[model samples]
Target: MEKKVQQYYRLKQKQKDIEKELAELRQDILNYCSEQETNETEIGRYKVKLVVQNRKEYDDAKLYETLSDPEVWRLLSKSDPAKVASLTKLNVISEDKIMHTYALKTVTLLQVDKK
Candidate 1:
């Protein structure tokens, strides 16, 4: 069991290292694209596209107030039933789920001596 835990930790560390390398390579590609002023390029059947996504952040309290309003929800339910249903269901279900009842289990290699 100890050996398995050690292996799991080693594998997790290796995965992180690979992920870091992958991110660096992706950044390098983006840098090259920016230097060339190209949005998309094709190389040996591989197509790379640089897309910029913009988003607006609203105050959660205000947003929730708007969403929870009966009139606003009714309008949304008519125009966008799926979105309204998803938001309403998530709100109700999350409220019913108690966070303390959940247990998150993990294995760690670090040893602590208790006096």
Candidate 2:
């Protein structure tokens, strides 16, 4: 409804269009590189390269299970406030023990809606 909001939506639409075009071009480049059995393609002096990387990602739950160390679990795990509150109500955990664990935070967000 406002000028800034109108500009934001307009720019976002252009961004989505550009991103879609880029993705299509990237797929074409990747396909060309694969077909040529080369990692790069040259346009005059400029090169469009396809980089393949093997990234290492460890499963947190599996690693935690395998290690089975209380210290490790303490370091890796995060306390869910709702779960903690429910457990606290049942007398499973004390309020005093978890008193300083919670932190207060403020967050602001913008959401765009289509009408």
Candidate 3:
């Protein structure tokens, strides 16, 4: 009976930890989405920095210059092969459309950090 109780308590603790981590991940996603939705006009003259994960798959580094051009989208994609498999692009769209098209690559979910 004592052993069973110990196992149950351990399981409960593990569950609590998992739940905390999940909440953290949810918050991160919310923050990212919110930032993306921020109005460009309200952003003032400051530059926004995004730490994108994944780069090699999209060949994003070479395209940074083009993105910075006024006539083009001011975006950049950088990758660290050792950490992430490929590079990710920062595609800025209007607040009305936050979802990437079916043709664009799907967003990769990262592992939730333990609290």
Candidate 4:
């Protein structure tokens, strides 16, 4: 058990080291791209593209508020009886119910520095 724990820690540290190196390399690529003022480039067989994209996301707070309204809730319950029935039967909807959705603005740098 002790040996396994030690090995796990060592592996975790090595993973962190590799992640840091990757981040540094990515930063370098970004710096180079900015300096050159180019969005699309080719290095050997790989084509690198940097793009900004707008992703669709649900507003959970607004959704919950909409659901919480008696009129809207009734409409939803009427429209989707099975969904409301299942959630009610499972006893999953409570004051403590925390529904989470990913609401991240992610910038993708594709195919960076590939040969």
Top candidate on lDDT is: 4
lDDT of each: 0.55, 0.58, 0.43, 0.61
Using TM-score as the measure, the top candidate is: 2
- Model 2, position 48, has a per-residue lDDT of 63
Candidate 2: worst 10 consecutive residues by lDDT? Answer: 106-115
Which ranking of candidates, highest lDDT first? 4, 2, 1, 3
Which regions of candidate 3 are displaced past 4 Å? 38-115
In angstroms, the error of model 3 at 109 is: 17
Where model 1 places Cα greater than 4 Å from the true spot, the runs are 55-58, 70-115
Model 1 C-alpha lDDT per residue in residues 1-115, reported as the tens digit of each score: 9999999999999999999997787778777777888877765557777656432333334444545667654554432334544654767424233232223343212111232
**Residues 3-112, model 2: lDDT tens digits:** 99999999999999999997787677666667898765575556666555432233445444543657635644644555546656886556665555555453222122
Better of 2 and 3 by TM-score: 2
Clashes of each: 0, 0, 7, 0
* Clashes by residue pair, model 1: none
Query: Residue by residue across 1-115, what tens digits does model 4's lDDT show?
Result: 9999999999999999999999998788777777888888886787777886644243545445636767645544432434444554676443233233214355756465667
TM-score of 4: 0.54
Per-model TM values vs. the true structure:
0.52, 0.55, 0.32, 0.54
In candidate 4, which residue pairs clash?
none
List CA RMSD, all candidates. 16.2, 15.5, 15.6, 9.6
- Tell me the deviation in Å of residue 114 in model 2: 40
